[model samples]
Target: MPKANSALSRRAFLTSSAAGLAAFSSIIAFRANAQAAAGELLMVPAAPNPHGAIERLFLLHGDPLAGPIRKIVTESGNPVPAPTMESGARRVLRLMHFNDMHNHITDMHDKRGDTHRMSQIVRRMQETRAAAAENEVVLLLGGGDDHTGSVFDELLGWEPEEFVADAGYRVNSAAGVDVAVLGNHEFDRGAEMLRLGIEKDARFPLLSANVHSSAHIARDRDYTSAAVAEVKGMRIGFIGLTTQVDTRIGQPDDPDMGVASPVEAVRNVLPALSQVCDVVVILSHCGYGTGQSRSGKAGADRMIGEGDFDIAAAAGPLTDKPVVLIGGHSHTRLNAEGLNPDNVIDGVLMTQAEANGKYLGEITMSLAADQGRTGWFTHVGLHPIKSRDDRVAADDPKFDTFEKEDDYDAAFEEAHVAPLRLALQSKLAEAIGTVTAGDAVSTATVEAERYVGENALLNFMNDALVKRSAGFANGTVDLALFNATAILSGVAQGPLSFGDWYDVMPYADQVHIATMTGAQIHDMLQSNAKRIVRPEEADALDFSGFISRGFLHFSDGLRYRLVLGDAVADARAEDITLHGQPLDSMSERQFRVAFNSYVRLGGFSEAWNGKAIGAGVPGQIQGMDLRGLEYEESGLVYRNEIIAQIRQDGGISADAATLDGRLTVA
Candidate 1:
């Protein structure tokens, strides 16, 4: 643990006493001294009501008895009073946070993730800080995933003259981000690039407690597990956690680096942080659930064993101080409108904004030392920062006045956001080809109907992959397969721009050709069948409730019929065919399959029985042995290959993207 602004430091006291006393004795003495010193800095409540108060508050959130969290209007709203009973003067701390920005720096006029409106968000944070009362402290925190997605992420690949690489870091630095947690996408380009990006552009420290790295990210220099900041004589401690799923992304060059269970990591850090700081905040990128929500539904928001719920549950027993977890990775908008009951878990107040600068999360907390240890959330607000067209008028009269508030500053936009926008404009607008007019491949519908059957967009992408992979495979590519979630968006029936395709598939994943036996293929398809949620069995909302995972969409040559059943495991994929011939599951017949690097590298985890899934488990692909798989990387990005095919054929039409009788869910 780093030395905090306290009278006695745990590390220092332990080290000084180590030589004079036994190891166990030294630790006990150090704790005794630390506790004595911490008592003066932070008071433990006479009757700590962590469990009872939080449970009651969570169950009755927004109800008058729970002291409903009120939204603050920037224009005219008065400061909210402390919800807890205060015996003396109360101090306020306003915390603002956002996550999963994903390098969305461009102005997407019709989209929700655009960071063009970032200037307004920055202005809001600045105004809040400046207007803070003498007893109030305001802070800006980032929940991670600040990079990846959008054309801006490919600025290094584009090699533009302006040298706008790592735009997310640059933007965060310009926005005056005080602290941020490390996200999985930060490792998408490997540890070296991540190190370079952080070193070159990050002004604030990026922290992760679970991540242990030797090469790219190092302790202290690159990041720290925990941090402390002093504001208006109050000490705030922060612990950062990254999802262990990042191991699937692979930082092979940094072989020593690995991500551990976030729960255990927080437990280790809490002993040190709890003794020094008045309050502790967990900066988490481990997501919100353990492969399923409290309602028992599975989706991409799950982080298995490394979610905030698990961490909070573990940390509750170890610390008596006020703890709040600001979460990301799931991109979940917790407390979207106001304080939500579901967000409080194990006595921890959780807050998360929707991904991609869509919302700015503001939380006001009151801390009072006179009434033992009293720290409680007074207000929670999520400010929508969308463009004028995307703005929806708020029905509640309390927020109606600020609903259309455009808090943009001309100087901020011109100085920080405009130059990058101008740099990518010409390249992004360049027309690659046109989508022939007709029923376009709708990404929304494709995702909605993904688990039911094959999707047009996925089929189109896989077909293009098969055609392109054949050249590099040195043999006929039998078929192509990939997850439907790989397609970020859909193409419209109009002139297609480079930006349009970038939006459709932004991940820079390469295609790989692998030989799979008929039996292995059958198993993969059967596993895909298990994830199918039929419309009759589940509602559309349930089907599309969370991000779809492990739902396979294959090329035209493959065909299968899904026999729907009452439960997930009871469902089956049968009558499989390949190129007009029945595929014998037990046969030794091998088919060369083209798939993206993500699938081959175990990026996709099959949805099963709501169990927590671990990363780097190659068995997700059924029987494909990672140790001796006969496969060759094409060294070509799947998206770029699709782009090349589009350029070669001039454009794709409705006929080319239509769903045939390749897959049928009966």
Candidate 2:
């Protein structure tokens, strides 16, 4: 991996006079002079005096490329515009924001091959900033989820002492990320691991206003709730806010550390940030929607209707400081119009680049001062990080496929990222065991099939959990259950590599067992009926919403027939049996159930909403509370358990292990 010293050296060289005149333009660089004081603003001094009197003006045209060119108005010393505020006034602040990278270091899925390579993306931004005008300041920001997606992230996370942090942060730091907001996934491995592993080595500020820690870990952790940067004489305050979902999805690093509500967090932090800065930007990982209606050409109004807490709705009323919100988590692509059909919001602008480093969102904000008040407006565009297709028309005889070559920096990749990429490929390409499926499968196939009913991949995962629980839960675990969406992708019917399996189950969730009564089990299954679509209600079904919530997938030993009724609330799960015997319905009858932490803790709101198994239910099951259950940690992550099962069974046979009639939907 590239070192931080090399990054600093590169930046110093770019700003040096020997690099050329263009290098001197807009030298707003992040300099690590010394360890920044907690909450201290990293201020870059403004450029030296210009040749003559310059008037700075901000133009809010719809075009991103259209900005106020240099305009010099010379009069015989009629008090030239004050150098402090008006000298570089014409320059616009250009921000490159990306979120939910999920450790996608390579452009593997880009068939067109024009997407941004992680290394190339950073180099391109640096080059752009190097050539920018003195007044033009470029800031790169990450919205979060910098850990736990790819095999490299997993491997590097396992070896934090040598790697310093996850590969994503190491690469991003080398790529020159100014600041990042903490996402829910950053806490996937627990807060302490993140603090000691990733946060300890981060080159930039990782802020989260809502995430609080009272333990000793907080003493060494330099993370602050907010940060300010002085870009071209203007102080821009950044208030970071993470989703409150960490309480449901993952364990906090410290026993005392906890996340506060995003709404309240924002409201509390805005006043302090606004007092110190001309403009305030909210760096959030809370997401624009509630994991539903992620994609569509829907306008802001309709999109807002689909979401639980959108950018405009969350931070709009908090303050009037020309706020710009960069969001993540739902991976929704938002534009400048702000989610409203009319694409207009008062005193605010919202934007988010899609996940996986596929696109880089650039927002050029034109700032103007009117009667002692500063006004900020923006022109936003999400640009694809394309690959270089150098094939010429003469080279490709079949169909004239000549196209404009994309801007791909080869030297940057070789120097900063290629070594790490090669290492990851070498380590993760090793074959673990042969994994087969009854039919061809991919992320799309498994996702599409699992929506309506049971599928082979989900069944395979449930079986692994069942087998894993027996060893740890005192051999009392009766059945294993999981959400269909937990199986992210499917393996091909061949020798499965570790990378392939990691892709299928990338999260860090662990297996857990809880005891629930037969009545509670029935209520849990009935609650799943909310996601089912009856024949008559097909027209009203929101497919995206249902899929986002996902359905329950249980082991073969636990069988039940789901009988759909005219209304979803009336649906019945009949003939429920455990190991071929009718389940006892006595109030005292109990069955030990095995499941991942996500389900055991009621993280799947759609399945546990009205059920008596988890929290917020009227008649909660005794000893079935999310955290109160005498839960035993299986000590193995979900993927490792699956790998262990596959290895112990010699090789998984696809045809023999087909989905049984365990969960029949009619």
Candidate 3:
């Protein structure tokens, strides 16, 4: 067993040939970097037969070639060759797709015991590559969302460990991504940082057809043109399209001011790109549909629907493209037509994972000499990413001796992650305030919002918000709204600690207060209520879990009743009463909505229509006497009354208690 290297050699080496540059006219590459590890074997999956010489290999082709490696290619993404079922030459293209890995390097937290899971997955990938090496060669592709700089930036008000280095370790340690496009989050570090990050340790061609680097390529034009990867006598034109919505995400690590429209970017490059590669595979960071909703391709899909790129564009798909998409953000459990077909236009296949490193998109593609191909994929066999949980499984023995151990932990400051996150760990480790004795919870729970009972971390955090809100404490605002997007993964009950708070509410959204009209308030609560079931119907909904099983506990003195039924359209004026009375439409009652800053800034939740005054959420640095009052004391301040009201809402109907529970059982 070959040990994986923990750190990637930062110095870049371009393996591309510049000989055909002027002849191609538009093909470009300033630096093509694809470095090797310590003799890590790249193998292909073994053909489950004994008689045939099934080749299994993981190819280490240098950066984008100087010219197309295959005959008959398309630069326009048009003129897609007809499908050739004649599986002659037996070419099997395997791309190891990894996406949305938000810097979970260095098993400090051992998040969710994913270490064990990650090792197993990597080992499997290795074994598969080993088998294929005898015949078919696999392509390792990074789907995007590599650097989580923003998550750490907000957490520490500055850059933590060399995050880009950390991500490289993760990718390299986990068999290294051969060719990857950018995730929207990668921009969190901005251009200079990204350049600095990419300058040192990056060993692979980070391709993004749509995103142009700000720094010049020595010439008067863009530095690196989208790359076309040629694997095994095949001209696989690879273009990367990250979500064009980076400006809105606030990662800001790089200084590149704008994101060109991905659709337009693809359109601009397609003609020439088609001429360069036989098959075009778009590594898109565009998310799946709203059902997966961390980020969706409402934009990317619309771009493809316009029939702009590839024979088809698979936004975020799992299978090899006869053209298919494997998407990440807005992680959705998908395995289907990676395409959106149009009679007047070409089609595209798309798929997305369910988020947070649990699935691996695998596509087994067989290209025919006749020029066409056929493919299908499944979401099965996918497993959790590297585990981060440490208490129970600090050291997975398998990884203990892996050669890359030193490299993986070296990128990030192991000490700071723990010290910086100490406040969250312990609290998250224990069960918060218990449910009424028998309040049931799901087995194998880690996230804050997964459990189906009263959660201490959640309630306490909300309660803290409620207490700190100017309107709630002083009586200027009416009812407030703080959607659960602010919290994820629950803490086990025990001595309340800061680590618990950090883990549960890992994001950095400031508390927001707003005064909404009775109509807005009504819409908001109704949205919250629909999560009882029918998640699709709750498109704009902010809360979901089992309502009766303590889906959420709205702060005390805040309550509304609803008579819900089938279709959301049927939702009429059941009554948007506030504190035992009909909402006084004539009375200008300002509502102080307490929530994370992102919500107020219009994140996944409804836009904050500043009808009421706004106040920043309290945190650690507010200054002494002011500090104590403004400081955030993690967990809900625990007012018994608020809990009682949530309980009184009659959430549990007995049927909705268990997985089989039809409704959130009381």
The candidate scoring highest on TM-score is 1
Comparing 1 and 2 by TM-score, which wins?
A: 1
Candidates sorted by lDDT, best first: 1, 2, 3
Of the candidates numbered 1 and 3, which has the greater lDDT value? 1
TM-score of each: 0.77, 0.77, 0.53
Candidate 1 structure, TM-score to reference: 0.77
Model 1 lDDT, full chain set: 0.63
Candidate 3 lDDT, 1-666, residue by residue in tens: 112112212121011112122223232211223231221111111111121111111122221222222222223222223222223333456665656655543234433432422333455566567777322446656667765522333322224353323344233433445666666655543454455455444555565544543541110111132554444344455566666533233222223444556655554444444443445566666554321122231211111112223223422232233454555544455543432232112335455544444556666555444444343322222433544433434367655333333222422334333333353344335433333212332222423233222333344434444544442443433333444434454434323233333444444343334555554555554434432223343343223321111123354344444344454333233444566556646235544444343443333212232211011111111110101112221212222223233334322222222222111222
Q: TM-score rank, highest first?
A: 1, 2, 3
Better of 1 and 2 by lDDT: 1
Off by over 4 Å in 3: 1-92, 102-114, 117-136, 146-175, 184-225, 230-234, 243-268, 287-324, 330-355, 364-459, 469-480, 496-503, 512-554, 565-567, 570-592, 601-666
Q: Which digits, one per residue and each the tens of the lDDT, describe model 1 over residues 1-666? A: 111224434464334323322321222211111221211111111111221111110000011111212321111122211122223434566788888888865455444334355677777877876676655667778899887788887654422242455778777777867778998878765677777777777767677877774576675557766665545445566778888753444423565777877877776567555655557789998877764432222333333445777887887777667788898887777887788877777667888887878788988877654332344545777888755433444664444333233556667778877777778878788788888734547656655666567777777788887777656636668989886556666777788988889988877676777788888788677766765555564442444444445567899999989987765546788899998888884458988888676666664343322332322222232322232357775656677889888887787776667788799988
Model 1: CA > 4 A from native: 1-90, 110-115, 156-164, 246-256, 294-303, 369-372, 375-377, 390-406, 473-476, 540-547, 565-567, 604-631
Q: Model 3, 570: alpha-carbon shift in Å?
A: 4.7
Tens digits of per-residue lDDT, candidate 2, 345-402, equal 4456667887877678887776553311255556787866654344434556642332
Please report the candidate that would top lDDT against the real structure.
1
